[model samples]
Target chain A: MKPILECKGLGKSFGQKKAINNINLELERGKIIGLLGPNGSGKTTLLKLANNLLTPTAGEIRIAGFNPGPDTKQIVSYLPEKTYLNEWMRVKEIVEFFADFYRDFDPDKALTMLSQLGVDAKDRLKTLSKGTKEKVQLCLVMTREAKLYLLDEPIGGVDPAARDYILETIISNYHEDATVVISTHLIADIEQVLDYVIFLKDGQIALTSAVDKIREQEGKSVDSLFREVFKC
Target chain B: MGWDFETDRPIYIQIMEKIQLLILAGVYPVGAKLPSVRDLAQQAAVNPNTMQRALAQLEEEGLVITQRTSGRFVTENEEKIIQARRRLARDQVTQLLVKMRELGLGKEQILEIINEIAEEMKI
Candidate 1:
């Protein structure tokens, strides 16, 4: 399979402290990969570098064979660890913004999902419950027909009920041809859907394998292996 | 009908296999429709998404088929059930062997326990 994303000797530093170091990796299309790690393991930082929200202090990254330029941005949808949508915007307005920006935006899908989740499009972002807003963000991200999805902690702070809903939308709505790379600490909740697993530690990759291979060879769930590999 | 809370194995995959076992047992007869993904998920206390994934996997394996609006149904082919059962058995045996190894048990001990369980299960 051709890698849709590749990073070689990737490194990033915040002044004197390093967030990631000398990493090498590749992600193929049509796979759901979990980027698993503890906090400060450089999971978010590497995702940022992939999205080009930050540049690598060393090494290289290529999304769809192109550096993260406007062209690459068109193909990548990102859900940040923190809310990136303006709090002043209404829910419908946020939908409109994403619809306007991405050619593959599915407005009807977004509208249908919003109704299903019982989120009111008329409510201002400021008025909706924080958890609801996160769901809305995830829904909009799903509306995109992008090739690569960079979801940072998509279910990090949500209740288990909401987490299941969010994860379902992700699996059901992603285009069959698309690739989803979700970075989060919620392993057991997501261990079911993941086709691949990447264990990141200290900003470098510790393990990356097809989920099936990992399960077949290791004789343990990804959660168990993750605990053993990155003991807290 | 429901998910087992034991084992670190994912609940979705378990539900997926459980649905197949149900079909094999004639609980969901050939061509008989199954429960809604949401309802089954609720029954398992699993996220509906996990249930959907399990159902989707079944669809992919040809043991089940989905009709838009009508709902998912067990395939009429008994071969599909046989195949699904074989796959599930292989995985179960593999996991069992691994657990035995972890407990430092030899093949003789493992087979003895298997025989005891088989008598209990009457399978």
Candidate 2:
């Protein structure tokens, strides 16, 4: 089977500053991958490039044998770092909106997750706390049966309890054929859930290896390795 | 129900050890159906693939059996379970002996220490 996401010599620059450079990656389906890096390391940029939110200045990125476009968008579910929902809209409204917009969206699943999170669907987005909003966004994103999930800092805002639920939700929602790519600095919290990890350093691919391989060979956690690699 | 893992070891190996310990303790009794891989993964907060690998290792060791249509189950053979218990006990003893040797204790001294501790425990 073709890799779910593939990139070769992929580079993206914002005029003078290059966000990511000469990146080559081939991610398979049915795995959870962590994209680890410090601030300004281009983790978000890489995700955005794959999601077709940004055009690569050099090289090419393909999702399941096709370039990033409408077809790829249909298969890729993305949760950006910032909250993009309209504050005036109610939780159920947004859920309905997503259901209407994305063919793969499951409103029932979204509603169930929201209730499980103690979030009321009748409440407007503006009334909820930041953490709650993040939860809602995650619920929406995860309810989609996309082939690839690109989540940026999915657990950064929530408390430990919510973080566990989010992780469980992620694992339970995807099928054996879907791939989840999570970009975050909280490597320790999500390390166990990841099958593989790709370390991004200064706009370049630093390292990519199976999580178990890192523990077995390096005799250290992925979090420890990340700290050592990106230490100030 | 929490699964604790050491950072230095491979997660799948840790998971495999955990399941073996559970089986030995009768937590997952012989011939009992095991939970689905996804459920186990969620409970352990690890990847499903990792859990699958661990369960596969268990199957290879004859500690688990997977049916075609039905789910996985613990081995029904009591003899196999007994052998597994012995093997685990041997591994533990080997590790303990290695630690004793590292502490500069001779075989006689280690035996004496073990006898003293066993007497104290009345076993």
- Runs of candidate 2 with Cα error greater than 4 angstroms are B101-109, B119-122
Off by over 4 Å in 1: B1-16, B27-123
Name every residue pair that clashes in candidate 2.
none
Residue-level lDDT tens digits of model 2 in A196-215: 99999999999999999999
What tens digits encode model 2's per-residue C-alpha lDDT throughout B1-123? 248899889999999999999999999999999999999998998899999999999999999999979999999999999999999999999999999999999999999999999999999
For all candidates in order, the CA lDDT equals 0.82, 0.94
| Model 2 interface CAPRI class | medium
Candidate 1 - chain A - TM: 0.96
User: lDDT by residue for model 1 over A1-232, one digit each (tens)?
Assistant: 5588998898999999889999888887877789999889998998888888899889899998888878898889988888889999998888889888899898888988888888999989999878888889888887788899999988977777777677667666666568899998878787766778899888778988765566657767788888899876
Give the share of true interchain contacts found in each model. Answer: 0.11, 0.87
